[model samples]
Target: MGAPVSVTCLSAPVSVTCLSAPVSVTCLSAPVSVTCLSAPVSVTCLSAPVSVTCLSAPVSVTCLSAPVSVTCLSAPVSVTCLSAPVSVTCLSAPVSVTCLSALVSVTCLSAPVSVTRLSAPVSVTRLSAPVSVTCFSAPVSVTCLSAPVSVTCLSAPVSVTCFSAPVSVTCLSAPVSVTCLSAPVSVTCFSAPVSVTRLSAPVSVTCLSAPVSVTCFSAPVSVTCLSALVSVTCLSAPVSVTCLSAPVSVKCLSAPVSVTCLSAPVSVTCFSAPVSVTCLSAPVSVTCLSAPVSVTCLSAPVSVTCFSAPVSVTCFSAPVSVTRLSAPVSVTCLSAPSLSDVSLSPSVSDVIISLEVLASLGMDIQPG
Candidate 1:
């Protein structure tokens, strides 16, 4: 141990207490710091405004409230923070990433993963229904439709689909319609939707022969004549005919009117202006009342025979008028008419008579 030393200075008197050689001591002006060259040593300070600095070959220095640097020769390298203020950095592998409050399962282990949402249920229709669906993107679009409905569209996608309800197809142009009574509607491709024009019928009718005149009729329109039959093709389209329900025109030729009895060619006794007789089918026979050597028959074969001569006969409007010629005028057996008149006027009064006969087997003569 070193002895105590006293030192007198102008400013103050100081004393030093040292325990060993090469130790540090101080007065009121300086802080008392103790150092040892050998082993461990301890020192205490009892005054304020004191400062101490330590340096050693194998030791660390720590300053409570001053900027100081310390170096340790050898130490285990480890970093741990517990119940103290320390800054730390992480340098390790990674774990998993989780999203909160997710009902469906989703995991991102791959670059491109598919996330699917549950699709709506599809029911069965007679024609068509949604079979399946898929998502190409985050969100997907859907449509549903059925068949057999007639469709007319101005601008369409060429096709459409429906999931619910039976489809009805009709033509806006002509009277064409496609109805789905019990059959479900189908996917109507504009290329060929059930055509409204395509239909079927079960009945056919025919007439035996022509009437007094042949007439063809269509209630709504007219029919086309094929051979002797009239056929109605489309009820929707325009029906037209030349002679619809009537003859095109009645053709009648007027002949010189004259009367004839059955079989014999004799002079035709016609009254007033030349008579007009209508020539119908079949031959007519004319008979002369006065029989000469022979009866003269007219050349015209028509039922209405034209006589070359005009016989004067005055008569009034009566259904039947007959005249009885006396001995001079009558040469044959002349039948009496319903309304009979005797001979009149000249010395040989020639009575003229007219009678209507049908299908009589009597002799007829046409006058020259």
Candidate 2:
């Protein structure tokens, strides 16, 4: 048989063996097995499990209702499973697999592969050079026991556990958890929270949610949380954190940093090195331990405290408090609300307070 043959509507189990010819088998309701020796084969099944084995020619298998298993020895393989689980194993050539309903498991011993899953979990174990996987509905778990991997998830949570190669993950709807044991990782979350814990590499996280929390513990971390009720904490790394809403808190234990809070009721705390913090609304507090600190508050009821370095505090509206224990302190209060309080205490250094247009009873001091 050297010509193309097409078979349709077989209600019993169908078995095909083709040699040096093209074959197209379709509309089968039972189990189908196809073995192509040297020619290409295309198999489509309606409600049955399909098994395809290709020696040196390409194979394309499409299943609508049952699980599909494809094994390719030399040429490329493309498998599409609509309602059931899919398993694909390729030895030398590339493979492209698409699954719509159930779980998908793909293992490529050698060769690059691309896998996409729509409604269930995806598990990919690649031992080749590179792999790309995308998941839409359920959680995705990828174990890159070998090469570099790039994963993008849309609806559910994403968990990437990488051992040696770098991983990049992007999530749109649910939480993203990345545990990088040896390589660097970068994660971006749009609607849910993000958690990253790295053992030996750096991490960068960005979260955009209404009440999102970002926690990073690694070598170097940069976090940006862009909503209300945001809390960012970094331990044992150089951290640069930015919070863009009210009731925000930024805390760093061991690094020099710059923090900016764009709403009211904000707090910034640093342990070592110089820090520059800016608050754009009222009820702001800045506390520093060992380095020089500069704070700017645009609204009322501001507090700045420095333990071992110079403090520069600027307040645009009233009820400001600036206290420095061992260095010079500069305090500026612009417009005081009615019954506002301005208290400045510099223990061993000079204190300067410039109050402009105090609408109520306030204190003004000028050094001559």
Clashes of each: 36, 0
Off by over 4 Å in 2: 1-9, 14-27, 34-41, 53-57, 73-75, 127-129, 145-148, 164-166, 182-186, 199-202, 217-220, 336-340, 344-368
> What's each prediction's TM-score?
0.12, 0.80
Cα deviation of 256, candidate 1, in Å: 48
The sequence of per-residue lDDT tens digits that candidate 2 reaches over residues 69-147 is 8888878988888887888888888888888877788887777888888888888877755778888878887777657
Give the top-scoring candidate (lDDT).
2
RMSD of each candidate? 45.6, 4.0
Q: Could you tell me which 10 consecutive residues in candidate 1 have the lowest summed lDDT?
A: 88-97
Q: Model-by-model lDDT, in order?
A: 0.23, 0.75
TM-score, cand. 1 = 0.12
Tell me the lDDT of candidate 1: 0.23
